[model samples]
Target: MSYARIGKGRNLPEQLEDDLRKAIVSGELAEGQALPTEPDLAQRYGVSRSVVRDAVRLLIAKGLVEIRRGKGTFVRAARGEAFAEALLLALARNGGTALDIEEFYGLLLPGIAALSAERASSGDRDRMLLRAEAYLEAFGREALDPSSDGPGLLRALFEAFMNEILKACDNKLVELVGGLLVRMRSFRDLAPEEGAREGGVAAIIELEERAIMGLARAVAGGKASEARAFAVRLCELRPSLRARLASTPAGDMPKLSFDMLAPIVQDS
Candidate 1:
């Protein structure tokens, strides 16, 4: 694998790490490919085996490689679980509430929708429309049985639709952030505000579903700004939704993690 021509400024280990990292990120060192033996790397880089080991250790900590003891050190796909946990913990420790996450996601959704509109292929657009319709249908069934986990099911379908949009956006970091935000909380978590009427709740839910359909249509039609505007319109309904769903019983929501995230995970 090739790295940039060496400059003699950094410490030995750091320099080696930088070159190896470049190689891996540039796909010169392919994923799941084993690295050369320590002595071989040492000889190739004109460094001692100890320096090579230190560099490899650095790569391991960066999630760029895995050691299999008797097997060898191979490149690994990076996962965001540790990053997500650390970030979520940091938010909690810093006194960030669920509303903070909600607002954060509200700000992110428009861009995501716009990106989906701009980037999605015809097949992706078709899937986006299908998922959006599924979510709308699920939401309509929420009032059919309050005792059932209808709200939870609706939430799942909504997440699945958004996951499709996120995937269509073709950005891994954006997808991860959006996924984390959705998991932070839902409308069911909001306190039931007094004077929330059934009529008002139904109206708000209808409006929200319409916005979802609009977003999907905009994406399918390649109307980026229209998709973004639909997303913003959806966000605007949140305050009303908080009041509307205030009377929704906790029992109406899912009690455990079941198949809610299965769609996204399965596709991944």
Candidate 2:
């Protein structure tokens, strides 16, 4: 295993933490790889074991490493766990409302789509299109049964599709902020808006299937402008989002927990 060159600086522990974090994030310390023993790290960095322990503690807090009982500390694949935690804290502190989230998306998601169009590899594009296709197949099966969990299924599918796009975008910031999509699903379930039409759940599913297909095609075709435009069009279909965006509520908003947001399966 390669060790970072330690230079004299501020707090030795903090500098050690920075060095380790950079190594982990840069793939030098690969995921699941065992970190050097505390003694080895201390000797390598010319620091005391206590300083090494402090640095390891910081890495643990950041989700960069996992300490196993009787096993050594191992590097973790940093998959936005820290970002999600930070965003949740920020949202809670700032009184994040549904409209606030939607507005953020209005600015963020289209850009994400455009970036996906520009940067996505062929495999990434194929995977995105495949997710849309899978959604259609799942929706088709669900549509035949009046008692099916159409809305719930669609929510899952939509989230999955968007996640694929986020991955395709190949941007760390986009991937981090993309976590809001999960919270947005929770917000949508908060008040439970009616299906977009009288034709009921199946109709709603059909419309969403079409919209997602259009989005997939634009993204896969590598048309950045069209992909972004399609994302805007998809956002317009959410009546609840529109309503939330139009008015800001007064006083402290009710706290929303993603845990309580159950999938809405209604009988037609």
Cα error, residue 84 of model 2, in Å, equals: 1.9
- Clashes by residue pair, model 2: none
Candidate 2 C-alpha error for residue 256, in Å: 12
Q: Which ten residues in a row have the lowest lDDT in candidate 1?
A: 259-268
lDDT of 2 by residue, 123-238 (tens): 88898998899867765565444335545665577677788889888877777678555545344222223222344555556565666787898898899998898777665524
201-249 per-residue lDDT for model 1 (tens digits): 5654555556677778998889999988877766653344444333333
Cα-based lDDT at residue 132, candidate 2: 90
Question: Candidate 2's error at 135, in angstroms?
Answer: 1.8
| Cα shift from native, residue 124, model 2 (Å) | 3.6
Against the reference, the lDDT scores of all candidates come to 0.69, 0.69
Stretches of candidate 1 exceeding 4 Å from the true structure = 1-11, 46-50, 68-70, 78-97, 136-159, 167-208, 237-268
The number of clashing residue pairs in each candidate reads 1, 0
- How do the predictions measure up, each by TM-score? 0.62, 0.71
